[model samples]
Every structure is written in C-alpha cells, then in structure tokens.
Target: MSRKAHSFLHEYPRIRVDRFTESRERVPDFLLPPRCRAGAAKRQDEDEDDDEPGPWDDLDQDDESTLKANGGVRFFPAPTIQLLSHIHADHIEGLSAPLRSSAPIYCSAATKEMLMRLESQKSREKGACRVPMGEGARKRPYEWLRVTAKHAKAKKKFTGLAPAPRDLLHALPFNTPTELRYSPGVNIRITLLDANHMSGSTMFLIEGHRGAVLHMGDCRAETWWIEA
Candidate 1:
C-alpha cells in the first residue's frame, strides 16, 4: 500500500510516499452493523410513515462528520511533490497546517480553483473577507504559509499547477528534477508525471542511487499518457 524511494544511505535525505489509490474511483461505502440498520428502521417507523423518507435522510452523514472532525482526510504517506487531483475534503483535508509543514505541493488548475472555492465558502461562513491567492501556496493561511516559509528560509522552491500557459511564470516548473542535499554527499531527484485523474494530480518518478520509483496519486493505469 505504501512505497519509498531513497537515493543514498544517509540521515533523512528524502522519502516519498507513493500511490494513495490504484484508481480515482470511489472506495466502498462504509457499512454499518446490522444493529444500526435495525435501529434506523425503528426510528423511521416512529418518525414517519413507511412511505416517507427516514429521519436520517443520509446514511453517510456520520461518515462526513467523521471526516470533518478528523480534518476530512484519508491520509497516506506524504509525497515529495504532491499533485492534488481535486478539492474533495477526503482528498485534501490532510493538507492542513501540520501535514504541509513537510513538503512543497503541486496541483492542477481546476483543483486549485476548487480549493479556492471551498476556502471562499469557508470564509463567507466565518464572516471573513476573501483575500487574493499568492504566487504559490506560501501566501495561504497557517499551514500553507508556514510550509512556504520553511522552504523560503532554506532557499528551496515550491511549485504549483498553472491554470493556463500564461500562468507558467507563476507556477513551479513541471516535469523537472530538483537536487536536494539531504545530507553530506547525499542527494535526491524528484520528477513529476501528469496524472489525468484530476487537473493537477501527478505521478512521481523518483530516481536515486538506491533505485527508481513511480508513484501515481490517483491515476488511470490505461491512460494514453502512460504510453506517451
């Protein structure tokens, strides 16, 4: 379920978490115990006629609550360069302050748009005015800003997906490898592969002295790009 790539035998040079899912399809819905169903049926009968909708109109309410309470994430190992596919909470909740303190993030234009939309909605709900996005996630709130600060202080660069070719200057150079000095005489190379799953979802191709690894975040195996 998890894989790692290390180029050298060094102290914490770099580690990449690969492939959150085999594909971008929905996982199985959680199934409650039979007792829950029985209890719901009883409550339904008492609250409304058999033909009426049950009091618990949505069985997945608990699931959604659990996700939100848990920051709406299904966390996998973190990636060196994360390419988000969409703005779904489950796909992105882990992108909170703590998680982002570790690595630079990349995503598709559509995905960023969706995330901005959600942030705008949250701002409206909290009665906060919307602020413009910065050059990268660095300009974002706590998690993003902190992470960006760390990279900036270290003279590291953070890249993001561009909505258009015009956005290229503002975006992180995609499909390029950057050298990281994890430790003395230890270095690593990280490359990005476009994952068609979402606007900016990506598959990582990491090469090091140890070995080469490819990680698909949420991608179609049969995609034509795979052949290309």
Candidate 2:
C-alpha cells in the first residue's frame, strides 16, 4: 500500500508534464537542480543493486539539456560572498582547495565542527601530524564565519581538530541582525533561523537595497524531535 501511494504521488506529476512546463516557463529566474542540466554525471555507481530509472527520466530532452549548469556554490564575479547552508557533502562538493582558500565561508558552528573533523581525519590518513597546532601551522582552508542561535549556549572548545586562524572564524549570534558593509554606506543585513533539518542547519534572510530573499537550506517542515 505504501509503495502504491508513493508511485501515485510520483507519477501523477509527470502525467501533467505540459502544465508543469508552462508553469516553469512563467518563472524565468528559477534555478534548476544540478542534475537537470546537460552533461551532469550520474551519481549512482554501477555496483549499486538498484536499477530503477528516476522519475525525471521522462522530461523533454531539450528542456532537460538547455539549462545553465551550476556548481555547489553559485559564483558572481563582483562583490560575491559565499554562504554555506549546511555541511552535507552534496552542498559542499565544489568547495575545492582553490575555492576554499579564496573566499570567506559563512556557516553554522555545528557545520564548521563537522568540516574540521572531516579535514582532520583526512590529514591523519595522509600521515600528517594529528596534534592540533597553532594558526600559522594548521589553519582552515578558508575564512569561516559561524552563525549560531541567540538563545544557544556557547560551544565547548574542541581540541581534536586542527586549529583555525583566530581571525578567520567569527561567530554571530542569531536574532541579532548583522550588516556586511561591502562599501562605504552600502551594506546587507542578514538574519539566521533554525532550519529544522539537522544539527546546525540554517535558513538565511538577506535584505539589501534590491530586495529581501530568504534562502532556506535543506529543511524539514516537521522537526525530527516532534512526535508524529
């Protein structure tokens, strides 16, 4: 019964492909998922047992192929800031050494801890020293700004991970709207909210001269801790 209901919910949308396409056309600025672009590599490995095709396989060839391809982080040439919503591998895939070293990354404290742990583990596997060192010897690949809830308590110091530059990690309390002064008399106000997805997931509300945009990272409408 569950399988049938799932199939119905999934396949019913495809049955009205024409209406969906028309609706999509009305929103010109809408961003397409990474996989919808042409030349996107299949994420599944051949060794996996499941062989079922995905629901989107039936999309029109042209519609699926023509969208501009995007990486994990969208790049704007002028006055660009990188906001990391979470620490999921998929969201952080394009955060290579070059990109990490070049830009400032804004994320939550929990996400930062996860990233540091992952990096530390990799360094250990590579035969690098596991002992935490000073900023000059062992700094994060990028400048990390931690956004935390206002009511949340201060995090305990973690000594297992490598040390990040003291100047690199800045913690911003939630509910306190902060302004990023990009230029003289020009700034952007940003607020953070609990995402209800996982530990440290966040939703960002950005306001500037142009307009306000709420970027919701991977979030769940119903929190996991709530009783169903």
Candidate 3:
C-alpha cells in the first residue's frame, strides 16, 4: 500500500534589518511602527514592575496547514498557487521579476488596485510612452512581475524557470469562503479576514482535510478585537 504524503505550512526565514537597509528605507512610513525606527538611545527603558506585554508582543505562533502564503521564494518545486494578503512590497518581494512561476496569484480587490497603480508609476518612470485614461476608463493590471531583458537573461541562465503570466490574478472578497482543490484528493477552504493593519490588509484562514491554519499577515491585534 502506498502512503499518503504529509503536508505542512512553510514560512521563509525573516530578513535581517541590516541586510536590506537601503531597500527598507523605500518601504512606506505607515507600514512601520514608531518603535521600529527609533534608535536604541531614544528608546525608553522598560519598567521592571510593569509586566504587561507591549502592543506588538501578542501573537499566536501555533498553527498548522498545507497551504502556503506570502512565501513564494522558498518553494523549491514551486507552489500550485500563491496567496497575497496585502500590497506591501516586503511581502511581495519574492514575486519580483526574473523569478517566475505559473501559480495563480490571489489577493483582495483593493490590493490589486494598489499594485496596478504602483506598476503604472514604474512604467512612467521608465520613460514608457503611455496615454492617460479618460474619465471612467480603466486598464487591467498585469499579474506577473515586470523584468528587464538583462535580468530575464540572467534568471534564465541560472534557473530555467519561465516568467509567471500576468493574466492569472484573482481577487477574493473579504469574509467569503473560497474552495480550492489543492491536490488530487485534497480540498482546502480559504477565507480572508480584515487585518486592520493597512488598506486591504488581510488575515488568511486555510482549512483542509488535515487541519486548519490562520496566517496573520502583518496584523495589529487589539485586546477588544480578540475578545469579540
């Protein structure tokens, strides 16, 4: 008898702050907390008597699932699908140009709009001649990352992977349960919850035959919010 393959959730190692100093600077200010930018000298000393946890200290670390989200780079054999919780550049960095996969990318409608705007800005900065849309005119954004010819050639030589198609973007509605066929016999249900961290930020709940997992992507949890 053949044994069933074990499935588990995976996450890429967190990037060290010092390693991406320059890149981190470009991240939007609203995405970072006040303490994250304050130097050691500017930080207030912790009160020994005050044992209360800070705002960002509360987090649930235990969860299980076969589905992966916001971790496209670490999948060696490539994932069948990708889930994007928000439009934050850091979370989507791995989906950048030159590294391609055919997996369908899922995200919120607001996130898709923001990505399209960002891409349009990038195109204009590259001196690409484009006409401004008239009133009520809209252009659909490409789903894949845009790579230069030089980077594309280098990527092809090093990793023989094809570029991810820009047409595979899917937008999910908040709080709606979406069914996904993960494998031949496995089915997963995904629900997107508002994270309240930023515009279009989301928390993913993935439930499968094995177990369920809640993946919080950059969420700001409040006591009241949790108790409710």
Highest TM-score scorer: 3
Task: Give the winner by lDDT.
Answer: 3
Q: Ranking under TM-score, best-scoring first?
A: 3, 2, 1
Indicate the TM-score of model 3: 0.49
Q: Estimate, for each residue in 143-185, the C-alpha lDDT of model 1 and write its tens digit.
A: 2322243454444433443221111101233588866543246
> What TM-scores do the predictions have?
0.40, 0.44, 0.49
Q: What's the lDDT of the predicted structure labeled candidate 3? A: 0.50
> Which of the two, 1 or 3, has more lDDT?
3
lDDT digits (tens) for residues 1-228 of candidate 2 = 121121111221111100101112111111224443334465654434234443333233342223444322222122224456666665554343333333345667776676654543444544465556554344444323332432122222344344333333334555567786533455677776777877777776777654576666577877553443
Candidates' lDDT values, in order?
Answer: 0.41, 0.44, 0.50
Q: Could you tell me the lDDT of residue 167 within candidate 1?
A: 18
Residue 59 in model 2: shift from native, Å? 34
Q: Which ranking of candidates, highest lDDT first?
A: 3, 2, 1
lDDT of 1 at 228: 82
